[model samples]
Every structure is written in C-alpha cells, then in structure tokens.
Target: MSRSWVEAERAMVRRTRLRISALVALAITVLVAFVGGIAYTAMVHAQDAQVKRELRYNAQFGSPSVPPGCTWLFVLADGVIDDGLIPVPPGFPLHGDLDAARVSGQTIEREIERNGTEYLVLSQPSGAGRTVQTVFDKRYQLADRRHLLLALAVAEICGLLAAAVTGMGVGRGTVAPLAEALARQRRFVTDASHELRTPIARAYTRAQLLARRAAAAGLPVDHRAGLDKLANSIRGLGDVVDDLLLSARLNEQSAGPDGQAVDLAALAEAAVETEGERAGERRITLTVDRPAGPLVVTGVETALRRAVDELLANAVRHTPEGGRIDVRLRRDARGYVELTVADTGGGFDPVEADRLFDRFHRRPAGPDRSFGLGLALLREVVTRHGGTVEAISHPGRGARFTLRLPAADPGVVAGAGAEEVSTGFR
Candidate 1:
C-alpha cells in the first residue's frame, strides 16, 4: 500500500512538471517572437530612414539642378498621381518601377526612376512642401525575421528536452528512499520468521518427549497442559511464518498475478470453528455473523483465510478465560465487507494499541503467554488480501478490531446482521 502511494505521488509530480515545462516553453516562444518582431521592425525603420536621407541629399544637390553628391531623385505632388518614374543621374545603384509622387502636410512619398530603374516613392516633411523620398522593398528585413524565427524554434525545443530530463531524474531520486525502506521492512519479517522456526520446533519436540515419558510412568502427570503450551508455541511460530510468506506472496500477486472470487463469510466461520476446537475447554465463546450467500472478494483464498484465523487466535489468546468474545461479518456504509473481532476481557493498555500489529510486540507479559506474533500475522494476512485492520481500546471497555475489505461483486446485496449471546468458556 505504501509503495502504491509513493508511486502515485511520483506520477503527480511528473504531471505537474510536464505542465510547468509546457507553460514555460509557450511563454518563451511568445517572448522570442515578440522580440524578433520588434527587431525586424527596427531594421526596416532604419533602412527606410537611410533611404529618405539619400533622397533629401539628392534633392538638395547634384541632380538636374540638385545639390552636389546627391544622386537619387525626389518627386512631390499634391492632388493628381503620376505613373511615370522620376529621372535620375547616371550613377544610382537600384532598379524598380516608379509608381507615384505625393506630398502631404508632413509626409512625402513618390516613385523615383533612377538611371532608368523604377522604384516606389516615399516622402517625409521638409521646410514647406513635404520632402520626397524613395524606399526599396524590404526583402532583406524579411529574410532576417525568418532566420530569427528558426533560431527561436530551436531554442524552445532544447528547453523542453532539458525540462523533461530534469523532471524524470528528480522524480526517481525522490522515490529511491521509499523503495529502500520497503525492501528492508520485508526482509526483516522474512528473516525473523525463519530464525524463530528452529527454537519453536525444538520446544515442541521436547514437550512431546516429556509427555510420552510421563504417560509411560503412569505418574498422573499434567501432560496435556505441557502439550498445550508446546502446541501454542508451535502455533505461534506457524503464525509468524505464515505472515512472512503471505506478505511476500501478496507483494508478488499485487504486482501482476490474477485473483478470483473468494467467499470470505464462509472462510471466516470455518476458521473460527477450527480455532475454537483448538482452544479446547478455555472459556472463550465463538460467534460468527455471516450472510447466507458468499461474501466474495477478489483475492487468494488461502491468504485471506490465514489472516482471519490469525485475528481469531489473537482474540482467544489475549482474552482471559471466561471472557466474552464476539466475531461479526457485515458490510459497511461504503459497501465494503468488514470482519470484526471484539473481546470483553480486562482491556489492554491504550497507548500500546498503536503498535499492536508490530512484530514481536506482546502486551502485559505473563508466565504462560506465548510469543508475540499473532497480531503481526493478522496484519500481514489482511494487508496481503487488500484489507485493513484497526484496533480500538480503552482501560476498561475491551478491545475491538475491525477488518475492512472491498467487496468483489458490488451488485450482490448484503444480508441481515447476526447477534450472539453465549458464555465464554473453553
């Protein structure tokens, strides 16, 4: 579950990074386009100014009663337009059609023919009548705008690539720690289970030998009591082993394995009955509240049953002899199936409830108590089956554990609830 949560977080971060990068790229493209447009406009304006200067110089000097060293021609008119080109001196350098000559209050634009070359005429204001000027077409400025646009396009591409690379790198780095933590946690459970199996087996064998020897001697020994203790110890070891293996298997299954419908209600009742028999004359009452049909779930049946059995065993072990115990299976408001186990023993330490499911955590140690693995195993079983367990306790009010699981077929209606009233005895 934690692993899935971390992956979800990484996905969100990746999406956010992509969106921000896109926005940045768009902003850069717009800014570059705007700057390029301004630069192109400036270039055209400067070129036009130079063309006007040349026209004015020619108007003041050297051409057909014009000033010396001024080579271009200028034509100014007020009303009617002229289609013919203005005559120019011998040395002008451009060629184009001269269209018209015009001078308004502050502007003069005219067509000028220079050395038999035709060009468009432009006019700017002078002392009295507007000064005439000629402007060539803006082919050079247009070429510059095209080149600027190409460069900006390349830069935007590079920026997007850089952003994507950086976001992925950072996201991977952030999730590395979470992965390491999960690996260590799984390994700890597996190694602990394997290590405890040896001592538990040895205790069971020794207890069996003692019982056999006592029975042969006909000493009226408490062989059953010794055997029960050994059995409980062995069962505790099995619980731990089951939890560890189940955790590992679920890890694999959730990754890719397929699951089928499992009837949890039936599974729970069978487990409770079996565990109740094991309790033998201990004052523990077994109550099962189940619907008529299957409370099916999409999961491995074995894993789910083991989890329920662990919870039952935990309640049995913790509750004092003759204390009431109740087990209920019902659906919650969200249509989730819940298996609840409640015990009316002297309640547990409220503060310790938080670590109830932790491995090797036992409560209020006593001489006859077994190893502290039952709750931990229960937690593993539920987790593997995609379920949740929560414990609520107080000083005197007994402990309650609720295991919530999603229903396999939401279309199935839940049956009526069941209540049990019975004496707590083995």
Candidate 2:
C-alpha cells in the first residue's frame, strides 16, 4: 500500500475511536447525573422529615432550660414568658407564631435563614392557653448534604475516565474488520485489472486486424461492418479495464512531496487537440481558452492528463453535430487552478447532475451512453490532489463541468507570462 493510503486508514481509525469515546463518556455522564440527582433529593427529603419530627417532640415535652443539643425552647403561659438559659442566636423564637398558636390553639411551623445557616421553628399550644416553641439548627444537615455531593462528584469523574478507556478498546475492535475489508477490496481490483489487461488488448488488436483483412479481401459490406462493430466492442471493454486499474492506482496515490508541478493550461490544450478529430467527425466545434502563462499545480502528470482528457471526451461524446464544446483553464482569484468544460448538447436533468460522477451510473438510452467511469475517476483524481469537481446542467441546455486544484507556489512559474489566449479547432 502507498504511504498516503496507510495514513488515510490510520486517520479513519483515530476518528472512529474518538467518536466512540465521546459517545460513551456522554452516556455515562448523563447516567451519573441522573442517579446523583435522585440520591441528593431523597437525602434532603429524609433530613427534613427528621428535623420536623425532632422539633415537634421538643415543643410538646422538652423543658425550656433542659432542651436537646442544638435545640432551644420557649414557653408562654398566662402572659409570662420563659426561655432557655442559653442566649438566643440572633433571630430567636417567632413571637408572632407563638401568640398566634396560643390564641388559635393550633400548631405553627416555619423555616428561617440566619447567619449563613438554616433554622426550623415550631410553635404549638401545650394546654390551658400555654404555648410552647422549639428552634432547631440545620447546619449539621447541610454539612452532611455537602459531603454526599462531593462523593457523587468524585464518582462522576471516575466513571467518565473509565468510559473513555472502555470506548477506546471497543472502537479498536470494531474498526479493525472494516479497515481490513477495504484493503482487501482495493487489492482485488488491482490484481484483477492487471490479470485482464493483456488478454483484452490482444482481443481488440485481433478484431481490428480481422476487420481490415475482411475489407482487403473484398468481403461483402455487411461482413466488414460486423467485424468493425466487433472491433469497437473489444476496444470499449479494454477502456473499461484501463479505467478500473487507474482508479485503484489513484486511490493509493496522493499529491505529496514526490509530486511534480504540472501546467494545467498545457494539459487542457493537449486534451482538446487529442479530441479534435473525433469532434470534427461529428461536425462539432471544439475550442480551448487559457492563460498564456502556465497555470501550475502539483500532482501526478499522468493522472491529471487523464482527468483533462476525460472531460474533453465526455463533451465531445454528448455534443450533437454542429454543436460547440469549449475547454477553459485559468488561475482563479483564490490562487487555485480552474478548468471548465462546457458543451452545447442535450444536457441532463438538473437532479441527476450529482449522480453523474457515481461509478457505473448511466443516463437514459442514447447513442452516447457510456460505462460512466470516466467522470468518476476524474473526480477521484482531483480530490486526491486536494481539489474539487462540480457539474452544472439543465435539460435542453448545455452542461458544464468545473475542476479546481490548488496552485503550486508562484516561485515555480515566476517568469511565466500571464495573458489571455483562445485556440479554436473546427
């Protein structure tokens, strides 16, 4: 495998592992937060219940001076008040509640905050117009809640860490098979293409020879035509095989340090020239417009040339007699090389534009129907070189294909002049 392919595989594995880890950690975090919330809520409810029970018991039976720890008592009987010996902590017994309970002969309870802590107070009528009030501190309960929260926080952190470790292990096991399958598929294509090339070439060559001999021997015109058709079929098959091999090879390669700076303008001119004769046979007008200077991009020359050729060939194939096909190359404002092929032909539907680059995707039955690998391979080449390809078309209008590739350093073409020029072939 090429270095680029290996690096791509490694990058895919890393991304998968990271995504798995993130998902697992998120699930664990939500679970920990939910469980902790429930636990904290239940603890707070139980503590409140306990505090209320203690305060009610103290109000009914405890003496004013001998109350329990963290508790204070007050009594109001026949308008004479008696409080505990200990000094009241700032906001002591609620006198309003005590009077209300004594007059109403009912119980009253409330919670109050003071001095950065909480207090639960209860006032109730003991008997014979006597009112008893109890005050309980909530600082101890608050402290226990704080301790529980700290423990939950610690547990949540530990669970996230464990989730990350487990996710990494699972991701490696999950992604291994996928990576191996891709590698195997690529290998199979390369091997099969190599195995089929020689036989296909031989068959195409023999077919052509047979057609030429049949004509030389004064065979009937129908026989000669059949041989010619056979030759064309073999040639088309060979082209498909060649396309498969190139696609596999391009996948393994990338525009790295070993790549050379190639002039995109020159490649466009050459492609137009190569297709000129075929376009002429169909009476189509073919042309190329480019900058006078070399629009240099870094890539494999053969692959770039093939991409340019495919674009021109596609245009020529679709264009009707007397229609026009134009190829243009230039350096765009973004400092990237751009090549566009536009043709006056029976264009495809707008919705089908994106699918045109799919491997083996074919249009409706027509004389120009193809195996559909050319555009697909072309896109693969452009993408491997850090570029983009786009198609635009509407039914009955012409189609346009645009390819953009990152420009090489200006230093590579420093002295090359930049002037607009157009070349036309009838």
Error of 1 at 343 (Å): 5.8
lDDT (Cα, tens digit) per residue for candidate 2, span 302-339: 67777888888888888889999988888889988999
lDDT of each structure? 0.60, 0.81
Off by over 4 Å in 1: 1-74, 78-192, 195-226, 249-325, 330-337, 342-401, 404-426
Q: Give, for candidate 1, the lowest lDDT window spanning 10 residues.
A: 417-426
The superposed Cα distance between candidate 1 and the true structure at residue 362, in angstroms, equals 15
Best by TM-score: 2
lDDT of 1 by residue, 85-200 (tens): 55444433222222222223444455455534545444443344433443443445456657767876777678667667655665466544555576667667667766776676
| Top-lDDT candidate index | 2
lDDT, residue 393, candidate 1? 84
List the candidates' TM-scores in order. 0.48, 0.65
